[model samples]
Target: MKKKIIVAPLNWGLGHASRCVPIINALIKDNFTPIIASDGSSLEFLKQEFPYLETLHLPSYNIKYGKNLKKNLFLQLPTILRAIKEERKIIELFITKNSTVSGIISDNRFGVRSSIIPSIYITHQINILSGLTTFFTSRIHQNIIKKFDECWIPDNSNSEFSGKLSTSSRKLNQKFIGALSRFKREELEQSIAVLIILSGPEPNRTFLEEKLISAFKNDKRNVVFVLGKIEAVQKSWVINNCTFYNFLLSEELEHKINSSKVILCRSGYSSILDLAVLGKKVFFIPTKNQPEQEYLANYLEDTKLAPFSEVANFTSEKLKEVKFYKGLQVAKVEFDVALFSLFHSKRKL
Candidate 1:
């Protein structure tokens, strides 16, 4: 009988769901039955993309951001625990229904994946994001990884092009998947210029879009704005040389990213992975109070893989830097080891 795998993705943001696209495709190619367990919004998206896959509703450990880190941490703890409990129950029930479930791969949903089957947890941050120094973050993260069958990081381990942001490692049973990006190069590259990918949970995404539109009103560069599907209600507006697309599918967005000279986007992992694989320069503006994005943006800036500007200070000068760093290129797909080997033995039912 064919192996059955279930992907339990966290619905905190679309990044979790988006990053799994390639993994799901790989599973489909390998002929593994891949079931998706996610919340309403993520399930809805997966339903559109893979209607054939079985899906179950799962709870999300949503974050509550405050102006300061301490306040945000305190506010979110309870919600996270509640979500973990809810997710545990859901996964237990799911495994009960699908006794053929061979393995579970979790994209940041710890509780659900831990509850059933041989579970693999995928997370770049192994330790808690806060209260940990750089010296011990990797060590702590590795300790956490011990709980799962395996852990996967979506980044290149090579130093030449990786920058500090994606080079972190956890030795045992941990794999680097070489930055899973939805964008793939197809046509010849063009230079119509700067493409800005606007995404993330709402209010912040809208806020950033408005800020960019305001700042670049008089700029003479070709700009493509992807407002995301959630923002479909937004009316299209042309400002100087910019063309705004309300929403873009993976293929269309890939074309825009390739055609553009530079990309301006939020510093989410999935977005960073896409830019990294394409070797495109990016001006990342991470969401406010979002520590993960902030860390990646800072790391990118420090390592010189990409440049970033705070939403408060995003300007034409920052936009100009994208052109200078266009020379840097990283080899894509350098590390794509098979995932099946991570387990002691493939459990076929």
Candidate 2:
């Protein structure tokens, strides 16, 4: 029997779920059965991505974000802690019920681990980007990360792709995975002038969609917009020169990315990894008031990797500057070796 590995990702957004696709595929290739666990849109996302796999529902952290995360996070801390504790119990029970399970991989889900099996924690943010509380938050997160047998930092060794986000100060059993992206780069024609991929938690997701639509609805360029609404019925319609989609699975979204000349998206780490894999130049508009996005946007710009703007400052005129910035053109798209190493020491519980 193939050793079963539980792959659990956070329910915050599709980024965590999406990045896990390549890892899940690698698991299957390495002859391991991957059981997915997640909640909310992320769960819906993986089900669509891998309909054949058995899935377990993990409770959502539901730490209300965006309406001021830095301010609201204080109010949600207790609930967040309780959620992590519950997640740990649920995973332990699952492992106990199925002694055949050999391992676990958690993508930022703090509690999805087991002492019985080899567990891996995957994250790019060694330096959690909370304003004022960054030092305290990073220390807390680092402690949780140390619980796993090994931690996987999904970036190059020097943390070139993620800047300071993945650079850990204290030593731990960490491996630098080249990069995690589901899409493969292909030699294709760039037919679309602009492709907008919007993601992250709600209110903000809807907010960006509305703002961009109002700004560019009249433009005659060949623009395509993906709403990132995984729950909504999949739909597409053309308005003026732009085509809008409710959501697109991996294959379809890859085609969209390869067909576009300039891509615009939130500077989420997963999105950055995907764009790097494709070796595409992009313009980013970080989600308003979100600290991580803001930090990534600035870091990418400061490093001359990509150009970004605040949501309010992003305009048709500002987009013209994207041509001047050099995206991660030098970053090699090599993911196999590091991914294969993920299974080097799998032990039966």
Candidate 3:
């Protein structure tokens, strides 16, 4: 019988779940039965991708963000903590019910570790940027991370793709697992001038969608806007010269991205990795008040990978300044070695 490995991703946005595609593929290739656990759109997406694999509906933080960055996060604190507690209980219950479980791979879900089984945590943010909550939050975050047997960073260790975001000031035993992207490198003919991808929690997602539509409504260039609303019925319509889509599957999304001359999207790490893999010129619009997206946008600009603008200041001129960014040179050999090592070490089939 194949060893069962539980794969769980945080339900923040599609980014966390999207990055897990490659990891799940790797796990399956090694002859392990991968079980997915998530909730909301993330769960729906995984189920669509791997119809044959068993999936469980884990509790979600169900975080909602508003225009007021500080107030939104402050309001969600209690709920976030509750979700963490629930995640811990759910993990323990699942492990107890399944005696064949071999290991757990958690993608940014803090409480999804097991005491009896080996657990690995995956994240790109190790050192939270210095801010008002930096002193307290970073320490607490590190403590949670230390519980896992190993922490896997999805970026090159030597030439860090995340700048200071992934760099740890304190010593940490982490494997640089390379950039995990669902889209692979392929040559597709460009047909559209721009492809705008909207993601993250809302009203921010809705806010961005409206903003982008208003910004480019009159432009004659061929543009496509992906609403990123997976639950909505898939629909498409053309307004002026732009085409709008409710959502696209992995292959369809990849084709659309490759077919576009330029891309407009958030500065989320997963999106960044996908753009890096495609090596496309992009204009990044950071979500209002989200520090991680802000940091990533600035980092990309600093590294000459992409130019970013704040949502309030976004304009057509920003797109003109975008230059091609050579994507991160991931150490594939290192990633494969680390991944294979994990599968071979415990509960060998």
Candidate 4:
């Protein structure tokens, strides 16, 4: 019988879950039964992607963000810690009931691992980039990561796309898995003049959507806007000069991306990798006051790979600037050999 593997990703935004698509697909091709575990939108997303696979909820972090960073973390930090504990319990219970499950792969979900089985933590941010708390936060994350048997970085060894974020100051069992993206470059016609993909947590998600829609609603150019909302069923509607989707699965999204002349979205790491893999030029507008997103946005621009703006300051005219930036950089799927080796190897812990 094939070994069963638990594939869990954090439900922060679609980034974690979306990147896991390639890994999950790899698991299937390697003859492992991948049981998708996540909560909220991430779960719904994977379910849509692999309806044939079994899925379970791992408890929602239900993380929300406001314009203020200090207040947001102070209030949500406790809740996040509690949720991590809760998810650990869920993972343990699930593994207990399914002894056949041989491994767990968690993408930015700290507590989704088991002591007995081979557990791997997937993240690009080994050094958290919050301005003042960068050290504290990075250390805290490293501790959580150390609990896992190995760390899988979704970047190349040079860390071109991820940069220092993917680099660890101190080494743990680590592998540079190259870029994990569920997309590839294609020569499709540009049916979408602009693709506005809005994601990240809570009111900010809605805020960006509203802001972009308000900006483009009266424009002559028709744009495709994808709102990464967590819902059981996918929905679509046309408003003004834009077509809006509640969410889109890989196949549909891939087409939309390939067909777009210009793309705009949160500078979320996963989206960055996705664009990088497709070699698509894009404009980034970080979610308000999210330091990580802001940092990533600036990092890409500083690297001359991409341009970003504050959502409040972004306008229709700004899309033109994307033509000047270099877009994202990518490496081949460098982790596949390493991933397959570990998947079949004896337990790391």
Candidate 5:
């Protein structure tokens, strides 16, 4: 019998859940039974995709940042540490109870996998955003990663794929897994439909949606907005040739993204991967006060693959001025040997 695998993703944002779609699809294609663990709207979205897979309600933590950077960090420090402890306990309990799980794959849930079992940590941000860290900080992050059997980063090896961000690291074991995208690449079609995905938590996501709606006030493109499978106030409105949807399913959503001319969305790692794999033209808008989004937005724009707009510069003029990549396909895609090598250890629990 094939070994069972559990795919656990951080619940703070839908990006973790969305990016895992490709991995889950690949696992299913390879005949591996994958049990998905998450909470909130992500759990509902997963259930919609794979209704038969086992599901677990895991706790999630989101670091809150206020307007004043210093005040936000001070307020969030205690809660952040407490959340880590809580997450660790939950992971330990799950492992103790589920003996059939042969492999554990995590998307940013720190220290959750079993010590004796084969586990892989998947993340794009190996470097913290504080930017004022000592060399010891990177070492500490590397040490935490060492606890896992493997580490996988979703990035292209080519210079055009990754821009400005330092891919350099002392850890030789890290692997570059070409972007795992949710959208499948398909033949080009002449269409005017546009799919806008709304993700992340709270005020920012909603705020971005409103900005997008306003930007399309006099535009000629069709638009549909997905509110990340959450239960929110719903309204149907049409502007010019655009239609907005609060949510959509796997096949329905994929169809829309495939047929669209341009994609306007967040610069989250998962979304970027999906766009890259599809070879679609994209416009990225990073959230305010979030350094990771800012980094991705800046990098994509600098690399010339996608244009980015910061929250402060979100306007119809900017969106209209953005250019999209039409004929670019990253041919050099490879999986991180460090990440999948854990399978060879024969470390069955």
Candidate 6:
């Protein structure tokens, strides 16, 4: 019988879920039965990608970020804690019912681990940068991660891509698995001058959408906007030489990205990896008051990887300043090798 592995990702945005694609594929290729568990659009996305695999609808945190994100986060702390407690119960019940489950891989879902099984926690944010709570949250985050058998970071081990985000203080059990992007590099003729990808939790996603639309309304450059709404039916329309897509499949998204001259998107790490893989120039607009996004945008700019501007100050001049980003230089290896190494090492014990 094949070993069963439960794969869960946080539903804050599609970033966590999107990054898991490479991991899931690796698990399946190794003849492990990978079961996916997530909430909302993340679950829907995984289901659409792997219809052959079993999936469960885990409870959502149902958390929302307001215009003032720091205040919103502070207000929602109690609710978030309650959801985490509920998630622990759900994990307990699922594991008890599913006797075949051998291990767990949680992508930033804190309560999905079990003491009885080998559990791995995956996250790129080792040093969380939330205002005021930065130090406190980092301690708490590391404590929770310690409960897992191993912590897997998705950036280069050399700390070239993530900088302090993934490389601050290395814990003994943490492993850097290098950047994991579902899309591979492909050479294609450029058709769109700019490709805008909108993602993240509610209000912010909508806010960015409106901002980008208004900014590009009068521009003559050929633009393609991907709304990143997976729950809605796929739709498209063209106006003023700009094309808009409700969502696209992985293949379509990869193709469109390759065919674009530049990308405009949030500074989410997953999106950054995808752009890096394609070697595309990017102009990032960090989501308002989300310190992680703000930190990443600034890090990229400081590292000379990409140029970024705040949503309020985004303009054509700023877009023109985006230069080609030379991606991380890491030794390439098979995607499955990193995942398999963990399981193989454990089996030898």
Give the per-residue lDDT of model 6 (tens digit) for 128-218.
Answer: 7777778887787888888889888887777666777776564638888877888877789998999999998888899889988988999
RMSD of each: 3.4, 1.9, 2.5, 1.8, 3.3, 2.4
Candidate 4: tens digits of C-alpha lDDT, residues 70-122:
57777888888898899999888888887678899999888898888889999
lDDT of 4 at 46: 90
Write down the TM-score of every candidate: 0.85, 0.95, 0.93, 0.95, 0.86, 0.94
Model 1 misplacement above 4 A: 114-116, 131-144, 158-172, 187-191, 231-240, 326-328, 334-337, 341-349
The Cα error of candidate 3 at residue 117, in Å, is 0.5
The lDDT of each candidate is 0.70, 0.85, 0.82, 0.85, 0.68, 0.83
Clashing pairs in model 1?
126-141, 127-141
Error of 4 at 179 (Å): 0.9
The alpha-carbon deviation from the true structure for residue 219 of candidate 4, after best TM-score superposition, in angstroms, is 1.2
State residue 330's C-alpha deviation in candidate 2, in Å.
5.3
Which segments of candidate 3 are over 4 A away from where they belong? Answer: 67-71, 324-340, 343-349
lDDT of 3 at 178: 75
How far off is residue 190 in model 1, in Å? Answer: 2.3
The true-versus-predicted C-alpha distance at residue 51 of model 1, in Å, is 3.0
Q: For model 6, name the residue pairs that clash.
A: none
At residue 209, give the lDDT of candidate 2: 88
For residue 347, give model 3's deviation from the true position in Å. Answer: 7.4
Writing each residue's lDDT as its tens digit, candidate 3 over 235-314 gives 89989999999888798999998898888999999998888777778889988777888898888788877888888898
